[model samples]
Target: MTPRFAITDAEIATVVAEFYAVARTHPGLGPVFAAHVTDWPAHEAKITRFWKNAIQFDRSYDGNPLQVHRDATDVRAGMFDVWLGLFDSVLRRQLPPETAAAWSTLAHRIGRGLRFGLTPQNGGPPDLRGPAR
Candidate 1:
């Protein structure tokens, strides 16, 4: 299927690789990721698949992101914003303006939903790793 934007698989991979490279060193997100991500390449590949599926309808990924985030106890409510901001910067730097905006919009929507699942008002715990479903 054609991507919603004029982005290619290679471009998406580049964006994901660059984003995580910076994210791994980010003060707010680094330690959280380090705790669970020992294999950077594998993690990035999975995430690439996720973005491919999200942006291009590639169906290359099949995982529950909400559940995965919920399982990561280090993920906090405020981290979603940091993640999205970092992702947005990478998208802007690696993609065309129109593509970046389109992808960022979708990412923010997904991040908001994930954040909601991790918040207290969702009839669950205040953090992701707890009893939040």
Candidate 2:
């Protein structure tokens, strides 16, 4: 059988819905995220566009994710972990095991990279990684 490279819009919608539900239930990050994403419809539209472009190369998205997340400032290190966990949960619930694993791996790497880039180097908040002795 040929490998299936396509994911349906319904699958994407399910994942997104599950993701938001998890985010809303997350301990520390939930309230902050809910407050920030007040415009659910707009946020959903943007996110849908993002995923569509990501998986299908349909260049309909036009937002700077790095800049937006950087400006959010509330997306701390632990929050990244929570976000990834939710993403993994949604993928697992909606897709085949192998597909979920692959997607989760990619999402984890991207999330980690984004978090690392967003973290600022300063004496303000103690460095995430301690200095060498």
So what's the TM-score on candidate 1?
0.88
lDDT of 1 at 129: 23
Model 2 accuracy (lDDT, Cα): 0.71
Predictions in order: lDDT:
0.86, 0.71
Per-residue lDDT tens digits of candidate 1, residues 87-110? 999989988899899898888878
Clashing pairs in 2: none
Residue ranges of candidate 2 with Cα displaced over 4 Å: 1-4, 122-133
Q: Output the lDDT of residue 37, model 1.
A: 93
Worst 10 residues of 1 by lDDT: 124-133
Residue 16 CA displacement from its true place in model 1, Å: 0.4
Show model 1 residue runs off by greater than 4 Å. Answer: 123-133
Using lDDT as the measure, which candidate wins?
A: 1
